[model samples]
Target: MAKTFASVGDLAEKTISFTELGPGLHAFTAEGDPNTGVIVGDDAVMIVDAQATPVMAQKVIERVRSVTDKPIKYVVLSHYHAVRVLGASAYGASEIIASEKCRAMIHERGQEDWESEYGRFPRLFEAADSIPGLTWPTMTFERRMTVYLGSRRVDLMHLGRAHTAGDIVAWVPDAGVMFSGDIVEYRSACYCGDAHFGDWPATLDAIAALRPKALSPGRGDALIGEAKVAEAIALTRDFLTSTYAPVAAVAARGGSLKEAWEACRAACDPKFADYAIYEHCLPFNVARAYDEALGIDTPRIWTAARDREMWAALQG
Candidate 1:
């Protein structure tokens, strides 16, 4: 029998966690599902990376109500991915924010990405019809910006590009915590469909420079201590290098995408086979790496048809 494509086979729901890293700072994690970061301030709350749909995002809202009755004031987008941003409506916040480039990417490829991702795994978009089209940032920044949920200062910066060209991290200086979107995943696979393999490490370095005491990574459980935080960063870098190295080597020798896929599996499966969405991410990761190795600077847009074509050709 043939294997299921992307996350179509992943139907089993994961256990969710709402962990506090500091006073009023919480991370909403669902096993290895997409994680949401919460910052409850003196007057209101700010949500980092809205869930995939209004229905799905309601879960996060419920958790926020458990801790505070304050209204959600801002929605900070870490990057432009359908799984992360499509749930903005549920927040009912005054401002929806993201980097300017992220907003452009949404205009450029958001529809196709939405179609591509929704097709990949309908489970994430729990109530697809509930999504009010693509989520847009009512506010945008170029490199750095800050939001004050009252006296609390939350710094949002586009440290460097890793997961996506416009990826940003939300930093809370007083609490020493950062909500690193997919740029830093925990035990989950880094979905590299739009990743920049060559530039990922420096982005990781920029993140390490902040010396965060804790992090709510894109997926997996929250990292609570500096040591655990360091481990997560290190492991994320390892996962990226281990994946890119073998695939790049194959492409350097003029190998085919299929060859690159096989090479990447051999090198990474041993170490990352158990990771959440590992199987789903491998094909996209290899394709992007192969393109980057051949001097492709920008990642090609992924559409639903293109996704099917790539998966069928790679047989991944």
Candidate 2:
């Protein structure tokens, strides 16, 4: 390995913000770090995505305590990523819910993902020793599931494959709000290391059809208006398209991976150079785009060693 990940030396902590989206829905955002959604109900609360570790998750618990005294009885996982799902133990939620595919992925490559992400995100997993093991869902669903928190109804649905093959979004019909897990991002670069680029656009359309009045994205700030929601969704689409188009063109012409990386940078740097995680996410995104363009239907698993090898090959 000739080069290290950009996140390795990022020791500075971000200022966390707890934003209220609606009556009881809130979002916990930290600059470009992963965000968590909060859903308070008549009976208890439901956490959308757990942070990277139990100690890291304590920040979210403190924020939740400030708002409601209701116990968090449900832990909902949006995807199987280690940085998102590994903090379930801190919540002590009775029922941890996720999609069937999400659980399958956890069983398949969750450990490798844990190692891969821990090296990539040194700051996010500072308390890596506190994590017990991989997180598994207590409750798994196929297409959609409806859970009633007393009078409020929250619908968890697998809209489509965007960020990962098994990503779910939580919709609160009464509040007209959606907690879109990495499926949507606002002013932040979407991580595509384990993504489905070909199927991501259609998934964005599905999110658009929801017509959410407010949304809690996976990163950046909380969207609190219809126009802002639309803008975020559109920008997310643009980010995806801008990233894949040039790489696809390069791949079709039998170009090298370095050539594809340069093409992606030339196309994306003008518009998204300043976005959060742009440098950290670009190499992985370019690699995935190059693979998808070459008819690789599934994204290859990323291990700690593979991350170093790929980084050296592309970025060195």
Candidate 3:
């Protein structure tokens, strides 16, 4: 039988936690599962990264209810991912926000990605049927957009592509906090199937420039203080670098995928072997790194079929 995680089992429907990172800004994390950030301003609230389904999003809604009753006026999608955007409709926000490139990705491969993701991780999509359809953003920005929640300013900036082609971060300057989407995961898989490995480092540099006092990453626990925040950032960067370097080296030498997989395992399994979903992520990560090292700019599409084929080929 396939192994299941306790966190995944707990998140069967949805789980919620309310951590007050800033005065009115709450992190609605889901039992160590994918997290959602809630920012309450003077006039309205903004939800960062909707859960996988409307039913799933309701869990966040219930948590948000515990803290503030302000109407959710904006649903901001950090990027174009089914698990992140599919729950957007439940927000009933006046506007849905995303980067213009995010919209284009949804237009191009939303359906494929939806199918691919649901298949790869069935546990994360417990209420998959409740998803109305591909979530589309009503408002799209090019580089950045600033919205005011009363007097507080929320800056949404596209800090170059790492996790996806249109990845963005939510920066609350006054609070010195950043919601980094999947651009910075803690003790979890980087999900590089749709990532740009070559550009990810520079993207991390942009995030580090903010010197956030706290950060809510895509997975694991939230980074509380400045030192822990930097620790999380550095750990995520190390995870990516350690995993990629060996794969890139083997690829550069014209080694086969199997050889490259062994190389990556030798390099990363020693350090990040205990991390969550390391096995599940390594094949995809190596495949992308292999492509990039060979000068492939765009990542190859991942389907349910491709996932198994790559895993089998690389594992054996």
What is the number of backbone collisions in each predicted candidate, taken in the order shown? Answer: 0, 0, 0
Q: Candidate 1's error at 59, in angstroms?
A: 0.3
Models 1 onward score TM values of 0.98, 0.98, 0.94
Q: How do the residues 90-123 of candidate 2 rate in per-residue lDDT, one tens digit apiece?
A: 9989999999999999998999999999898889
Ranking by lDDT: 1, 2, 3
The whole-model lDDT of each prediction reads 0.93, 0.92, 0.84
**Quick one: best lDDT, which candidate?**
1
Backbone clashes in model 1, listed as residue pairs: none
What value does the lDDT take at residue 72 in candidate 3?
Answer: 97
Model 3 residue 58 CA deviation (Å) reads 0.7
Can you give the lDDT of residue 245 in candidate 2? 95
Worst 10 residues of 2 by lDDT: 1-10
Give me candidate 2's TM-score against the actual structure: 0.98
Query: Model 1 over residues 172-231: C-alpha lDDT tens digits?
Result: 999999999999989999999999988999999999999999999999999999999999
